[model samples]
Target chain A: MARTILTALVSAAVMGVGSYAASAATLDDVKAKGFVQCGVNTGLAGFAAPNASGDWSGFDVDYCKAIAAAVFGDATKVKYTPLSAKERFPALQSGEVDVLARNTTWSINRDTALGFNFRPVNYYDGQGFMVRKELDVKSALELSGAAVCVQTGTTTELNLADYFKANNLQYNPVVFEKLEEVNAAYDAGRCDVYTTDQSGLYSLRLTLSKPDDHIVLPEIISKEPLAPAVRQGDDQWFDIVSWVHYALVQAEEFGVTQANVEEMKKSANPDVQRFLGVEADSKIGTDLGLTNEWAVNIVKAVGNYGEVFDRNIGAGSPLKIERGLNALWNKGGLQYAPPVR
Target chain B: MAIGVTNVPERSKSSGSIINDPQVRGIFYQAITIIILAALIYWIVDNTVDNLRRANIASGYDFLRSRAGFDVGQSLISFTSDSTYGRALLVGFINTLLVAITGIITATIIGFLVGIGRLSHNWIIAKLSLAYVEVFRNIPPLLVIFFWYSGVLSILPQARDALALPFDIFLSNRGVAFPRPVAGEGAEYTLLAFIIAIAASVFFTRYARQRQLATGERLPVLWTVLGLIIGLPLITFLVTGAPIGFDVPVAGKFNLTGGSVVGPEFMSLFLALSFYTAAFIAEIVRAGIRGVSKGQTEAAHALGIRPSLTTRLVVVPQAMRIIIPPLTSQYLNLTKNSSLAVAIGYADLVAVGGTILNQTGQSIEVVSIWLIVYLSLSLATSLFMNWYNARMALVER
Candidate 1:
């Protein structure tokens, strides 16, 4: 028994030493594996969730597929890890995921202290309050001495308190850790008001027993610029993900739909030709350590930004969210991309 | 010494050397284990440091003092967006304790009744108890929480049309609202009288036990204790001019206008934990009662003791000896399961700690705090239970 135990100890010590010497940046590992592990929110409609057919289809899920197309010529090479709000950052930090495509806000502390670099905002949202219309409350200011339901571990909770304190309102907060609980409390009449991002409010309202009874107050309390994030210390990986999102916006601006992407390769326009992977020697894809057909693959797999948004969250979908801040630059919204070249 | 050895009888000896001795082997094994444990810990620490550096993330607990810039849903103490992360964690700890304590109490009462019902002579009662245990024990706690929060609670009436219960209590899909106490100036005197009544009850219980042992006559101990607990407090309240009033909730145009409200997050978690844990507790209780030999009951009956007296005086005391150890462990399990509060967003320790971790980027610190707090709580509970068990142990002549 003693001899067996000694042998086991020595072998374990050797394995530990070997692993310590072999540790490297997860970005390189993900690149070599030809896939990016993306952490996403679990079952948020239009954000990230599976459909009835067990296939994931959402705005956030598209970002993950786009990154995979950028790295490899196949969008299906990516693995999606559905994580809770509390699990997203930890999964990224522990190297369990290569990128986080969940609808995370870009905050100063999260950027500098958490060792993450966020790309441009994909969704511009604001915290808002929703109350049952039976109360005849048209504005949030009337919610003095009210009981408000807010989700825990979110910016919504902070905004609710700030809005109340600034208005000198004395209110009690009915807090829950998950969005479902907040909605439940609101539906149950445990709270007179429910507060969250406007997009989330729309999605949650649809799940209520009487959707038309609740009215979203006419106030945008806080700026919520939802963006995609990648880990720090991997400039190569960061550039790849950033450019992938930019490509989608650029595609929309140049009128390169998935139906016309094949025909656009023969166009005389230099910018369209380059973005279509047919001009300027196709150097953009090569520079990012991918094949020249990368852009073609992404568009074919997921379509342009407008296509993704309209199908998932726009008027055509259940959420029916308007493209107020997410439209293209020429359309008078904040979404604009630099030249592909 | 050598001269005497020549005259001694020779003994049969094995070929074992001192280095190959069992005692030596045991020591050697212990030394190896210690060395391996130390080396493994060193390697993990080294790897973590290198990884953190490569990721460019700083690791420390200094972030606890940083501004939280976040707010919690339910807090017993005052907090703000500008409160420190430490304060947020304190709020989380209090929330966890509140849910755990309430869950344990409710689970115990339900579990004991169901356990006794399973051993009933009637076939229907036993079958019903069996069905209850099977249904709850088969389902996961998370699903149960969702079932209650969304499936049931969300279907309740609207705030304006709340279902009114007795004593000015209101129920709706949102949660239950109840009348809160409004203490008056003379409340202290009434509280003092209640405490005095409890002391009198304890004294009367001891006196009743001694009277039954010496004179072989029984006293109505239950009635006396009840009167001391309730009647004395009532008299004291009248003498003090009724020192309390109710803050009854009034229905407003939009919502309930006054009194206190309990959120559905807490209600769902409390309900789920109690029902789920009671299933396991019921099984433990049934086994405990069954573990007592049947001969003890028959012997008590042969001594001319009534059936009810045999159960109260002989059967129950013996079954408790078997029940308590397992019962204590079940209570601990319920406390730990309360951490699932993160799922339904009840602001328990794990959920609150998770938020602080995100705001500060201090994963190691936050996880360490969780481990230390939970482990210490477990240890303290175990120690207390051990002491109680020793006091209740049978003493032999």
Candidate 2:
């Protein structure tokens, strides 16, 4: 009798899986809500952290603001919900957030099985190891039989295991669920090494008890293409976010920064005129269902791509991270955008 | 009697009369309750199905076979990132059982001592036990965990400059490292003797109780059992040429080389849980003891029984009736409280499950597993405790 009831329950549950999945009109929802609900990291120094007055300002935070600027013409039309690494995907899946701009790596499972669309990469990074200076370990190969501290629920954990196995090295991982716990464990000498993204290493080092004592080893283990993601099946909303990202990179290539945007808009170059919406029929913005001056709004709110980078995490900030691969294509870097036409 | 009696005819019952009958009303209410309960269950199942469907999340146990692809800090069983998600959870389950069993043992011992101390005649002893109980019980368990984890353990000296203990034991912020025993050849004979000693002790207890009942002569059962259990094991070791030695830890460039090191994660979790739960157990003990009447002790004294004998013969056995029920709940609470191991990065069941839940996006499956594991653990504990209570209950002739 009990077996019959359980069978009936399983059939009912499977029926639910067979039904039509809910899909919301994200653009209309955002318009009705009057603000873009953006998901961000809980607290990562150079990526996303709130200041004294509780206003979030960082590299990822800037992308969220840029999208808000493109959509509503006012960058402040965004509500930041700080989510942990595990919570980010679920929040987006449930439509709790319209856009997830957290420093999440773009992966195949996330894009396909999780049913989300990732825009272009915002920051390119790779996994690396950091050891205390006194250990005299100059490279990743030296970390043999070491206990490495890493945060769980991240690509970093997977990469660490793969790197060790590939090199035929033995190491124990002291895994923590939260980023802060991992940092504390490493600082307390519970582990011989700390491993994560080199970008994250640079940011996390400053918060350590003795920052100068640790140095990141030179090893780019895996590609971590951090990008913004949106729920699938919303073409108009996806196009808007994707084009906004392209416009920022193009603005950087055209050298149209926030301070000189107005002067650049009046230039004789047709490429610049079309991009800044000054030309008679600059319809690139309208194609994505955004205003003709959408790029102008993005630049005005959070400057161009280079300006935003410098303001939040580049040499202008405390992190002082160099623009290695983040520089423009003409300057021997990977960041490039297609023509506005 | 015959003169006062009058004959009367019985009245016929109508069909409508059954509606007002008490038994009929009871049946009506019971039927209504069962129907309502069934409907409620059906409604919940429907809502869950609709939600999962709408969210586009696959719901099944099939996800358990997928690669876990994540590392746990500690595992009692062997594990790797390439292991199945099911294996990862099993490793976590074993770790949970390990900590809960150890914590339960340690907590009960400390709790009994403190409970007895609270009633001591010495002013300082009573005050100290009372303060310990009040302070630990009043504060949140999580706070105590953090106080040990981040505040005390993290502040210890580096692994290179470990505080050396006797027998090549080392203490540092990383962990506590001590010599691990290696069983040489013929150690199995000693192990076999140990088991034999345990079995003999059990039979001896039963025999001693029977002798006391039949002959009215008490055997020295405690000393005899202790001697048999320890003496057999010791003699076996000596006869086998003492084939057991320690693999002592040696100081290294960065860490201890040979010792078995218990990580700070497990240490903090075990200590916090033991101290926090011990406080509540102590209170339960005090209440159980106080529940025994003073008149019982005096009655024993009237029989010329010594004070210690009076407590053993008259007070404790009866006090156990009050202590057992609450003490069982305290054990269950400690097991549930072990879930806070996640906060301190202890690789207990819930923490490991949480990591898998995030990695696979299988929140529903993971939550269902947690519910099942905790439910089973609590149920099994309650069953054991109930059996014990039955054996200890007062009997009437």
Candidate 3:
């Protein structure tokens, strides 16, 4: 009965939206709706958590805000849908959300089979492990015969299993469907160790009952390039999301902070002028289906990538994580963008 | 026909107007309804398939052969992350059946006791049973699961400070760890002895019933059956050099090692489901018992039967006729509710299916599999119960 009802509802939705989708672009849909529907993490402290006033403010949240600001010239014009790890992809594929900025990993399987387009790695991360202080375990190699807690439906689960099997070590897995459940289970001594992305481990560790009692290990097992994803087959929409991240990184590379962005519009440098959309007859933003002030709106709304990181999970926030690999290319990092001719 | 009946006129074969004929109208309306229904189904399926194709999303069960890449918390069969998704789902199905079958047995036993207690002449017992039913039946099962998981089990001592029990068992927030029985050489003989003991007990039971009918003397069947089962197994074990040994858990640097552990996730899900379903079953039992007419009990008492024997041999046997049907529904309900194991990470069918769906992006196929599997399970339960109900049904001359 449930299957029949679900199929009916899905088919009805498809029939209603399919013809419109084939004719109209995602931008037009957003324009008609007057708000960019963004999917985000349910809660991850400095990543995408809601404050006491029920307002979302975090690293992933700012990306969606920047998208809304670029499209509508108003950051607050974006609505948020908090999704679990398992619900993120389908929600985007079904047109329930415009873009998924939920710290999702960029993988070939997701990009192709799941019908999502991902580019511009937002955060450079690696899978790591966290163990209790008293466990006296030093490295991931020494975690043999230990019970490890991890969340389901994420790359971390597979990474943990692969890493253990590669090293010929045996470990029991205690998996949960949600992040908070994994946290609670680990905190309750259900598992000796917790495993996830290193950055996630840091943010989630802060939410534990005693943050001082646990320590993240120093082994980087898998490269986890977390990025925002949009539904496949819409090259224009994909380009818009991809370049939004590049614009943030480019703005930071050009030393354009949120406060100095407006002033930088009057700079004599042709590159900076064109990037800020102030150069005469510049069509960079128009070609991407937006106004000349698209970059300006993004900068004004969420600032550059550096500022976003600092304010949310970096030194300006509680996480205090260093800009190890998320820095610009000139500063010894992987964040490099195309020239804004 | 009129000539034969001698009083009534014969009816015509058909109405003058075909539109006015009731049979023709009924068939026409039915045909129209069928056409509309078929058209609607076709439209929905067509649109859904077109949408999936346009979106470039893969929609098939080919991903079942792919590596699952994630480990389950508990599995009855041997499973690893290297196993295929199909094997993982099978493991999940087995886990679900394990919980459901155990929960049904435990709930039935508890339900019978509480149901009988509700009707006890003692005031305290009746009220306590009433309170149990009222409290559990009113609250949702999910909250009960959390209450056991987060509220009760999480507060237990950690692994390093685990509470040790007798027989090398240890209890902690993680789980209860006990000795794993390792069956060595000649262990099959003990299993063979157990099977022989069971067969002998069944034969003895028939013989005892026949002897009672023939000679008017009762045999001690229960004790004899118990002795046969236990003594046979013990004698075989000793004769076979006691080829079973325990790998007792020893406290290690982090946790107890060398033994099998039952995780708290399974424990809490099982406990919560059993308790929650037992309340409804208790009500069913009470209704079934009360449904038996009072004169039946009086009639048994008027005979030479004692009070206890009257309730057991007379009242309970008849009450079972009423009990078995609803009892089947409760069993089905418990089986379905085992899907709630996912909420607590018990690795039941729904939880495992959700993981596989996310990994492979086969939402429609996965949901269809779930629908088919659950329908089969429910149908199987109903069939077995119907067969049992037929046997217990009251026979009339």
Candidate 4:
């Protein structure tokens, strides 16, 4: 007993000393490491999963790359850490990753209590239900006594219960820990309905044995504004990341395509010139501890937001999600950037 | 007496002093350790607080009482997006328990059958069991879950074209819908009858055992107990007007409209955990049977015991002595592995805690709760197993 006490005391002392030394800014340490460790999902097709050649591509993936471009001027300067929903926040809290660009929802508690800051909404989604077409279910209200297969540990679960309860309907929930299981349960007739963010439903539907057999309910029960998140405390890093996203929006607004970025550098318009580093007097990039051409570099590396979305989850892609809410402000969507000047 | 005196000065020594005096060094080392530990703990706590404060994040469990504005995919109890964080977590805990219990029961039955098969005289049975164990054991549990869920389950028929199974069960790509029991007014009387029957059966079992010991004759206690347990409740049901019915599932235009539905998350986790843990349990069972010496069975046979009796009376009891300890570990492992429910969204403890943590940002509190719950579960299980093992152990003369 005495020996055990002694060992415990010794270890406690060591930990105390160790933690004291580790209280410094982790952002600085990340900068020195030359790569931002970004946590992402395993495989959501267009979210963070690997392609055929194991290269990460998607709107979420580009967000991380854009941050890398802004910080180091090299889009490839990032290490991707694949995390499950349970592991995502813990990874960020433990300093295992610098940024989480996965399709995580932005909520008040996460922002205030979890010590994380959601930069901006990248995808606007809502909780929706999908059922087999043979059931001919047209609305969520029709799922009175349905067995709903839902992924656990998500906003979708709450939305499901709320929707049912509000309608005075009873349902059984078949909960899975992962999206794949929910998909499986729905497919195997283990559940009567599968519900999640509509985008996720579309992604899942594509992999179904008979894709045309299922139909998503027309009603979107809950709003799910998905965004990238970064650990709080480093104001400078937060600004850099938040504005990296803003830069994308700003680039799109100023008609700065990757193909025309060079030509636009010599434009007569001062806002366009200032954005492309042709006229560096605005000092926007320098204020964030970066060069005036940071936005230019980001666009050159990953293109604008629309390009990234189109290549990933848009109509041109397999997921084929329309840019209804994710379109630019001028295009009648929620994406708006604070002017760079 | 003739030895030369080499020491010039004698050091001061206590009367009770010895070379290996534990009091002297033990106290000294313990004090040093305590001081070091105290310092370390203080530093870590200080660092955490400073870090959180610097990051402008509050660290506490107070957020658990806040409204959990998010939704859960599945819950046994009623929950809403406007529910408290505490309620959300409760739902998650229930989901975890559901999966763990179901997995444990199924895994045990499968493991026993496969274990017996592994020892069968028939080469085919033994080989099949071996192959089952090897294939499942070699693969990761997560992959197995995925394979069952996405690879197989997702490809089934749609809800409208559900493949009807026996007993009004419907199977479709969406999920299986089945008849659910509806308890009526006389159900209370039936439950009471069941309890009474169970008590009577226990008493009779003791009496039968005593009678057998005295007369050297065995009574069919198993059949008697079964009859008492089932017959009494069933008779009460008939006498009370049979107040039990099932709500059968019905097909609708878009989905199955009425019936009880078991979701895919439970199915995949249940299947995966059972198959994965069965491999380990099978190994334990095989070792247990092997541990029983051949002489014990031979002795029983020589005493005119039938082959079945010899196996049961001689081999099984002895095998159980070796099996219980490892079996307990397997049970604990299955319970812990149930935490993998996060992978398939089964709302197990870990997954629920994760949701709460994400919503509340109470990392310290959430992690503490997790550690405490899991550790206590581990301790409780081990304690129960130890007690059981002691009961089954060989008694010395």
**What local distance difference test score does each model get?**
0.79, 0.83, 0.88, 0.78
lDDT of 3 by residue, A1-341 (tens): 23323532463457448434632489888888899999999899878999999999999999999999999999999899888787776677777788999988899999999878999899999999999988888998999878899888898888888999899988888888789888988888888999999999999999999999999999999999999998877888888999899999999989888999999999999899999999999898999999999999999999999999999999999899999998889999888989888
Query: Per candidate, chain B TM-score?
Result: 0.91, 0.91, 0.93, 0.90
The superposed Cα distance between candidate 3 and the true structure at residue A73, in angstroms, equals 0.3
lDDT of 1 by residue, B159-180 (tens): 7788999999998765688999
Ranking by lDDT: 3, 2, 1, 4
lDDT of 2 by residue, A1-341 (tens): 12212222343454343222225567767777788999998888978999999999999898889888888899999999887776776667656678899989999877866667897888888888899999999889978778899888788988998888789877888887678888888888888899998899999999999999999999889999888998776778887778878888999999899998888889899998999888896777777767888899999998888988888889998889898888888988778887788
lDDT of 3 at B138: 91
List the pairs of residues colliding in candidate 1. A175-B73, A177-B345, A188-B173, A188-B174, A189-B174, A190-B174
Residues B128-214 of candidate 2: C-alpha lDDT, one tens digit per residue: 999999999998999989988886565788888999988888888878889999999999999999999999999999999999999
Candidate 4 lDDT by residue in tens digits, A278-303: 67456878878788889989998898
lDDT assessment of candidate 3: 0.88
Clashes of 1: 6
lDDT of 1 by residue, A1-341 (tens): 12212222332334243222223445457777777788887778888888788788788999889878777767888888887665666666655677889888888867877778897788888988898887889888898877788766566776777888888876777666556556666776767888888988888888888999989988999999998887776767777778888888998888877788888788899988888788866787888766777777788778888988888899778999999989998998999998888
Tell me the spans in candidate 4 whose CA falls farther than 4 Å from its real position: A1-30, A44-49, A120-143, A146-152, A167-226, A280-282, A304-335, B1-42, B66-84, B87-95, B98-139, B143-156, B171-177, B212-220, B253-259, B297-309
TM-score of chain A of each: 0.89, 0.92, 0.95, 0.91
Query: Model 3: runs farther than 4 Å from truth?
Result: A1-24, B1-16, B211-217
Top lDDT model:
3
Q: In terms of DockQ, which candidate is strongest?
A: 3
lDDT tens per residue, model 4, B1-397: 3344454333334435664565567888999999999997787677666666655567677777887765565678987667888887788778877877788788889998999899999999999999999999999998898787675454777677789999999987556789998999979999999999999999999999999989988889999999999999999999999999999988775467666877666787889999999998898889999999999988888899999988788898889899999999988898888887776666677777776765455666676677777788778889998999999899888
Candidate 2: pairs in clash: none
TM-scores of the models, in the given order? 0.87, 0.92, 0.96, 0.82
